[model samples]
Target: MDDIKRKYVIPGDVITTGPYRAEENVNLVGDKIIATTVGISEIYDSGVRVIPLTGMYVPRIDDFIIGIVKSHTSLSWELDMRSCYPGILPAQDVFGRDFNPKVDELTSRLKKGDLVAARIANFDRSRDPLITIGDRDLGKIEEGELVKISPSKVPRLIGKRGSMIQTIENATKALITIGQNGYIVVSCEEPEGLLKALDAIRMIDEQAHVPNLTEKIQEMLGSNSE
Candidate 1:
């Protein structure tokens, strides 16, 4: 409810009170909420989330992400979601409506080397991640340059309320789509602006923790303009 979240926290730290909703890698014991991960404690409008400074992608339900569709058979579609384990986009999950996988061309839905914007529907340690694209925001992604960075750096790439990504888009005159899994797609007409945007993203990924990152990014953009 309140944006009054503790910016930085470590394991065993009390991030908030028990009355608040607790996210994954966090525990609500008694009247206090405790952190189980070493990362920044962020309380959003909906709930609280701890962005781990270092860790592999742990698929969570409703996490909007982009993945490269690697393979698919009659039963399942596999995706490379920048995690050690490949995610599974089940036919049942994507075709719960009138659509039938058997009747449709598989490649039309997803193919090898194709990028898709989807959401994690289910995840279990022993099983592969299950994803879905029923939502409007989730679908096949095309015509954008892909940029991969550390999964931990995703939040920094998207500043508070999307200020950071917007800054890059405005300066480069490009449309950038950022996934929570650290996959970014930047589409620009001008090669010069595209390179500048890539450089800015790399800079953000490298120096995310430093203060004045926004100002520094502005400086870089200004120099390019001049």
Candidate 2:
């Protein structure tokens, strides 16, 4: 079904007038679905929502994120996850349960300016979010070009059932690590392929609300989706 429709909207703009359920960044006022933020408004079957063009990422438990090591103390490393609060990776999580602040320096493993792939372990309004890199897939990012896009556009970039990402990967041979927080790391063995992949990602960031985006990206990559 061609149930998806999108358009730019501003605060208080009437996104639609119907029985559509108001979702994120939108409010239902009587029969109208009103935009509660400046962004692209989406109308799908039975639902209406606004994908904000500007906003901070809100960390959620188990959300995979890309973070830049900002600083470290004796026992913990602070990372910038492009969110309101810094992500804290405790020494124990990285250095094992027997970690000692005196003998195990945080910088020994992760220094400032280093990038990492991690998951949000826990968070609450009262404190900074805690992150963990204990999982094999979660750890220091050794290489790749880091790219940032609005967090709201992440879903569109991923597309339905990982189709968009798979399309890009298959065509360009680029390994893309997508962060739920919108920080992406893309790498490829061939320089031309890398460039193409990066361009496709930028295209998505700029035009996520536009329809037929997967087709557009496929054209940009000069290949068909597998």
Candidate 3:
């Protein structure tokens, strides 16, 4: 069987399953075999495997991410979410109001450079990611210094049922708003407090996989204060 399989092996890859000495120009299809043109060869009975040589980012639905507000218009604001395209947050989607309001009021409501907590509402082939701030918790983020991180790391920062956020708040005595797109806004009573909060947030993002991290952070902050 191995010899027969080798006959169909392609030139780029050596036959892993067969040394059949069969005819050339044969192509192996739907078999538990793999061939590599590379010099290395090892015989194994397992199935064919191909490793990916490149990295790719594929966006999906319901991916909580952080984004930066890049521009604003009468109807919506544009956000740079580190994706292939920028996202849009329409005024109606934000306020849940059907009618358009005066330009001044809308501008005052959401200005550029203001970090917003939002979710991916939709996406079309021609348009960018549509974000919505319709939920109660989703909307204008207030009183927090925005810190950016990878969108993939947002789940770690939030933890299970917001445990990580609560831990940071308890430790540094600061308010924190973590946006779905990766925007983190932190506010504290003092500059020192803000710094400590930022450090704690970074630590949480790094150490969130560990169990009992909240307690560990609390202890660390307590020791530093004393």
Please report the candidate that would top TM-score against the real structure: 2
For each candidate, C-alpha RMSD in Å?
4.3, 2.8, 10.9
Candidate 1, residues 95-206: lDDT per residue as tens digits?
Answer: 6656576686666667899998999888887788888887887788878899988888987888989898889889999888888888888889999899999999999988
For model 3, give the 10-residue run with minimal summed lDDT: 49-58
What candidate 2 gets wrong by more than 4 Å, as runs, is 1-7, 16-22, 27-33, 43-47, 223-226
Model number with the top lDDT: 2
Judged by TM-score relative to the true structure, which candidate is superior, 1 or 3? 1
Candidate 2 lDDT tens digits, 1-226: 4869989899999988988888999988889889989998888889999889888898999999999999998878999999989999998998899998888878888989999999999999999999998887989999999999989889888999999999999999999999999999999998888888898999999988788999988887875333
- lDDT order of candidates, top first: 2, 1, 3
Per-residue alpha-carbon lDDT of candidate 3 for residues 1-226, written as tens digits (9 for 90 to 100): 3522112323455454443322222235444244433212333343343221111223456655556678887777887776777888887876566545663356667777766777787877867878877766777666668786655466667777987777777777888876555567788998877998888777766664467887787787777668
The collision pairs in model 1 are: none
What overall lDDT, based on C-alpha atoms, would model 3 receive against the true structure? 0.63
The segments of candidate 3 whose C-alpha lies over 4 angstroms from its true place after superposition are 1-60, 63-66, 94-106, 124-126, 205-219
Per-candidate TM-scores read 0.76, 0.88, 0.61
